[model samples]
Target: MKLRILITLSIMVLAFGIVSADFSLKWFYPEASNSTSSSDTFSIVNYDRMLYGATAGIYNLPDVNSVGSDPDDYLEIVLGSDELKNVEDTTDSSQGVWRCLDAEGNLEWAVGTGTDESRSSVAILDFYGSDGLPDIVSGTTSGWNVEAMDRFGNFLWTFPSPPHISGPYAWHSSPAVADIVPDISGLELAIGCNAGYDSTDNHWGMYCLQADPSDGMDDGITYSGWSDYPTAPGGTDGTDWDTIWFHPTDAPVISAPCLVDMNNDGILNVVFGTGWQGGIGGSLGQPGGKIICLNGEDGSLLWEYSTGGSYPAVSASLAAGDIDGDDDNEAVVGAYDGNMYFIDGDEDGDGTISGSEIAIYYHSGRVYSSPAIADVDGDGDYEVISGIGGGHLKCFHYEPSAATVTLEWYVDLGDSIISSAAIAGDPDDATPWLFFRGNVERTAFYSHTGDVLQIFISAMRGDNAYLYQVRGDGTVMDSVRIGEASYASPVVADIDGDCLLDLVITGANASYDSLFMIDFPGPDTIWCFGTDISIHGCETTEFHPQISNVYTEGCSLVYATVCVFDDDSNYVRGLDISNFGFLEDGTPIVPPNLEMINECPPETAKVDVVLLFDFSTSMDDEVGLMYTHVPEFISALRDVNYRIGIMVFNGCPTEIDGICNMVKTHF
Candidate 1:
């Protein structure tokens, strides 16, 4: 059988501009008043069915509502529990419009409806309620309360009973909950409250309470002074909460803790920072600011990182992601020292950030906001987005190898941004745009390559909030008035169920206290084609010298089939061996004839070639010549496929009729 095979090769080149796409603003809603600051990042949760946010403005306040207050800073929830339907018409320019308002002509679930700066960020838990939907939990910074509620705005329970502290600027920590304990069926929400008492000892660190959904407050959940701790630091006997992890710093832990599987070993750990000092220069030697990592199972020290300055504190919260795609989590944190750090969650399986695993980047001003990580460039690597007090939004390409990170680009937003920036658009679609608030001036958007795709410049000489559509080439297409004074980072979602993603954002100043939605009517899908190659062997041209077997010594030798066509035969006549064109090292190799080279050999040969000579006649002369040439002839046939045989006869032959008979045979 003839061996059949052919090899085809192809190299595919990827086209550029596959990632750059146009992202335009559809529409935006505005706030009703100018007294509130919606500073919290909206958490798009409940499987994207609900959007939750809070507002906090005043740097320091004695209580949630004091002498002067903006009552519009409340937790707002917009729900789309029912499936949204769209218009079937395809040819129409406006295919469908979003139903933002509910059947009752009101937005869904506006709980905590008052003007107290609720700074604690909202976290949506997968833990569901009796309604079979997930719930939202958050703590109030000024209110000094921790609470959980269902999706429909029903209050589950509130910590500290009254949800208010008597001291000035007594801030509560953001709630970090997880199913930590072994036997607990529900989650345990942990917080660090800065209720500074006169005596430092009275401040008994981090507090974790049972926020059980089933029991709510019925499960002996209440707050008291060291009553939660029987051993008591102040010589006062008190009951300690179920799990009370003491903060290392003498001061109260104001910074919220983040629970994550830092080591990726199926176990969780708690990471947080503490310090009241706004920046490194002021916080020096405060003893309140330090980044601490602890075990989640039982509060134990995993590792602790400090700036090593007199007061190098990490007052901002920490963000975690596997920026290197190595399945290892790294802690992304901004510090009062004006430096951003990337700490490897675990190195050498020791559950600690080694000296080599830590990488740092510095900004012109201190970073109060956390770093946001995403593959903004569609390069499969995450870029760190951080807003600094210097009014600059910086992006850094995270390269964990070689112990270095490089800055990609930074934009001067022209305002001291304390809020973390938000990133939207899919990297698979090759379109990632960053949205951030730059004080009272403007809300800007940009492509991953540091290009200004769109800019919503706050109008001149007026309290104007304009939303502008940006072209892919960094040009403003159109603008519209949306709201006023926004500090909260924008959140992206398909709220109207129109298939295109919409923007959900709120403002810091209370002109619009409620959450706003900008309907996105732009392209949401990307098209691409994969590359493939194929090949087939030559059909008409038949190669006679087919390779049968290959043998190799120092050099390789290939054996092939040798064919010789006979005249007037079925095979084509006048087959030329020179037309065979075999090449070795770019030199033509000519085939040898069959007899010259052992191209064709018979299976059997030399049965017998007998010679009988008459010794009585002139046999002497013939015998002499035969003896000389016979040895040489035998030596020549030694390498070939032939052997020699000889016989001698002395007597004459006696004829017997038609058959000739030998006279005598001698051996």
Candidate 2:
């Protein structure tokens, strides 16, 4: 449901490029372009045919999207009669709810509440595994609780169970789920705390709780020994509820901690940062922000790095990848001081980063941008893309040998930049760029098929706010104005599941409080998802759901299939011959197969043995990664033989099957 290594190509304005709403009016809910105000922007995920937006205030996400301001934050929104517990905010005059919308600007469901307010991020996974459905996991600004709820807006469980365990510690950090404790039964949920909006002295930390408590403890809290760091009694009535561990921090961790298994070990390491509340100790207020790595098993510190500056706070998040093909990930991040640091993620086998283990590159302006690793020059190696203060967007080529960075190019947009850059593939490029193509085991899509697309989001102060999509030469490919100002950068994803990607974003000023999606207008390429089932006989009389392929194993028994989708485009299952009536040649043959195929194709197209396509882990995965690359894979198959055959998923190459922690292949 999340990307470990964000793969991108090309270069651009601020972060990543997208097709703006100006070119095409795909959609904006409430129907009006300026119906609501999306105050501060947060993050969002379009999965299961829906979009779950978190805390979007327009800062990477939190721009001025209008999240509530309360000790117990609450937000209210209206979406197609499906009220997700809307709770109004006294501080906010606008009403824009965290929503789950389709590509056509149609809202499936919308939820807003007190415990649900100010959710800066969300994690989509089968938290409890109950009903075998993916649930939504998010943390509220002051909720201080890792919340798990179904897509229908049903409240499932809250870690530490009711009654204010730590007195509303504020969970600005999005909950991360992983099987950290193998012996603990279910999965583990790791989350961090923010400044708590506390005026003066207040401590911030992180939590490691059970991903699903139904399997073991019913209280939704358990941390083996709760050892390593420190554990405070969270049970209000003394019922004895405890968590895995609590790693304390002097300042707020407004940034979401990343959970990565850097070494591919079964265990994961939590990497995160913190910001100074005004400075803790020392005369000039020591740089409060720092990068901290925690041992996922017991909540211990793996390694830590401090950023040097007047008030160097890492408001932006950190990214990890193997820059030199060393198989070890290097941590990349930026600070408010306009500098980006590169840390050797214990690559030297010393388990600690020191002296030569770290490298620094300055953007020369305050940086509020998170780094995106991609290869823009197609030079084979990856480059770092980020935005800094003074309205500059910079790219640096990463040299893993010396752990140093050299500026490849820099552009001053004449405005401040707090937005992070995003990477994607332009529909026109031959190979959609992927991050670390050398690490074949990690990528989800087929490399060398689409070119990399880089886009930048500027932090403009006034109506000068604009979305820029640039070519590799720092020239504008396409530029459009999106309202007055948008602090948060929008994302380019397939909102309608059209098999094509779309751009979804929120605006500022008059266009705040609204979440809109615009189609990425370009080549309407079709990616062959296995969803296009084949039907024998190719007849027109019988019911046919999108027929993608038609062939016979032996030309005997007829086989048919269909890709059934509800209004949301989610796959529809559980129906057999009874779901639809079957008829053949006017006499109502009542074929049980339900799918009609053309009379045994006069001839068959030859298919050559191409490599198996792996639909493994990718940035977007409501369906398989192969969904986007299927077109190329099918084209390759057809070019060789003329028709496609049963695909052999060798895992691109392999998406890495966790069943054996190895690559998997099947007919």
Each model's Cα RMSD? 24.7, 18.2
- Model 2 worst lDDT run, 10 consecutive residues: 521-530
lDDT tens digits by residue: candidate 1, 386-426: 66657556667666655577887765544455445544443
- Displacement of residue 354 (Cα, Å) in model 2 is 1.6
Error of 1 at 105 (Å): 9.8
Predicted structure 2, TM vs. truth: 0.59
Backbone clashes per model, in order? 25, 67
Off by over 4 Å in 2: 1-23, 30-97, 160-169, 195-203, 216-242, 263-266, 276-287, 348-352, 426-450, 456-458, 510-667
* Positional deviation of residue 251's Cα in model 1 after best superposition, in angstroms: 3.8
In model 1, the runs with Cα more than 4 Å from the true position are 1-105, 113-116, 126-131, 162-172, 196-205, 213-248, 252-254, 277-287, 308-311, 346-352, 427-486, 510-667
User: lDDT per prediction?
Assistant: 0.40, 0.45
Best by lDDT: 2
lDDT for each residue of candidate 2 in 1-667, tens digit (9 for 90 to 100): 2112211212111111122212344555431122223462211211100011232210011111233232111111112111122322234221222455432333445544334343345555565665565566666543444556665545566544541322233565556667766667677777777534343324467677766655444333344321222333143211233366678777767566666666555567888777733211222122457888888888777777777677767766666666666766666788867788887776655667776887888646667666666665445666777777777777777666686788878776657665555445543331122111111111111222123344544456455555555544455555445544444444443323233333444443332222555321111011111111112122122121232233322211123232222334332221122211222223332243334332222221211111222333432242333343344434443343112123323233233333212222211
